[model samples]
Target: MATPTQVPGWIAVDWGTSNLRVWALDDRANILAETQSPLGMNAIAGDEKLSFEGVLISLIDAWLPSDARGVPVVICGMAGARQGWLEAPYCDVPARPSDLAQGAVQPNVRDPRILVSILPGLCQRDDADVMRGEETQLVGFMDAHPGFAGWVCLPGTHSKWARVSNGEISGFRTYMSGEVFALLSQNSILRHSVKEGWDDGAFADAVRAAKVQPASFLHSLFTVRARALVARDGAAVAPGGAVLSGTVIGAEIADVLGLLQPGEEIALIGAGKLASLYQAALGVHGHKATPMDGTAITLAGLTQAYHTLKTASERI
Candidate 1:
């Protein structure tokens, strides 16, 4: 039964595969209320088309005023995926991230209090790579560093490495390092060997080893269990997590090294721990990375889209 101090002019949403976040914002872009849900795109029942809208309303119904009509809801991320509420097609790369508003798609909604628009993700045809939510973070970063031109890395379950030049993403690559780490640590035989703690020395050394022998990267993964088994008093237990992490991330960096210029600027977009891990790993290879808060940048990107849409409506 919570209510905002003022009626929100619009809403901002970032709906991913596993989670959904919504914000009620005033006309000046200040947040009046915010909330999140586990009912992501994947959470909606496959046979129910109206499920997505229902889940959204259930989470934000309190924020909706009875007399207000068509409060704009700007959404980004997997909510626009092929399996999502409505498939907002990909906008090809080599394009300005802010231009995503031009291709935004409106989904069918029964609610009179809200009008939803989903932003299109970016794609690179020749490379056959695609991204959804990360583009918003990239656009937000560009809002802060409009002149930045270099590697922009966002680490997560599916990490993204994008190249930016003149405010447009020229190309990008995705890595399954985080997902791989999760699988190996949770599902594989390494599950028993790897634990919660991190060891910096073991991590840095593993990074060097993986970088030097990228071809044997797969071979190195098994050592997590082997190292744990052979050591006395479970000495290798704590370092197992770090070693596994370093190996995968190291190999990812190895593949991208050729694409980077000497002494180039690198923008690392993510939260504290993962970003710090990447910053440290990149440091091992003589690279310096500048970090930006993930949530702030995402909101900035959504804010940019809101303004763009607002201005366009004014023009019409």
Candidate 2:
């Protein structure tokens, strides 16, 4: 059996639907140890109530020292969903992202070695939009860019466009553009049509086409299919992935353009491929986008929340 790494003063967790990660942090906020599990909410051992605590206990049981008393664990993500460990209700927008700590919840568990606090998600009532883990990222981003005010685009499976003003999120919208691309490329016929490796020219042209003729966006998608099937050695085979991504993202960007101010720049918070793709796409509009690392933002946000909780606890 593998021995568990030594525990630290506190734990930071980002538990989502598919997985959960925990970082043991010293009092000074430096990471001492980190681990994760595939036993997320979706793959728990039992019902919502039983599974979360059970899986959580299983994951961190070895980390707790025998004499430890209520080791603080600050967590955020879908683990606090209605059906997860405990529902840390949604906090309405136009509120400081750092204030998420105020909405944290403590799940009732028999274990004395752990005290878990789950941060609340954010909601925009008017838009019928809600976000869980992303709010923490926003807080981290805001922490990095104090007094930042503008459109913040977080591209992923479900891309988010949030308006951050004075450290608070005024409003936001979620797009299924990434999911659309995935479905088209992986599940739909386009998967067979488009190969990897980007063609910048093709991507740029598709972006322009979709942005200008948003209504014909579906027609452009169909073109990829037709080109691939009709011509074996053709335009569609090489640049299918890029074109599909460009077309969907372009339409999304064009649609969301109204949310942006004239010549206003965007804060693109993401990492790796998604970040580069968004930067390239946003560049097409002549709009400047500043890139922020997703992992760094998560750490910053969690640290902020951990401190806020620490402060509150100290006050009491």
Best by TM-score: 1
lDDT tens per residue, model 2, 1-316:
1333566788888887888887777778777767788877777634545577677767677777878889998888998888777899999988786569899999887888888899999998996998999889888888888867788898988889889887788888999998888899889878876766779877877888887897898788998777666776644454787788888888888888756776555889887887887888889987778678887688789888988898899999
lDDT of 1 by residue, 181-263 (tens): 89999999888767678789888988888889989887899987787677898453547888998898888887777688865
Q: Which structure among the candidates has the greatest lDDT? A: 1
Worst 10 residues of 2 by lDDT: 1-10
**TM-score versus the correct structure, for each prediction:** 0.92, 0.90
Model 2 regions more than 4 Å off: 1-7, 45-50, 227-238
Q: What TM-score does candidate 1 reach?
A: 0.92
lDDT for predicted candidate 2 compared with the true structure: 0.82
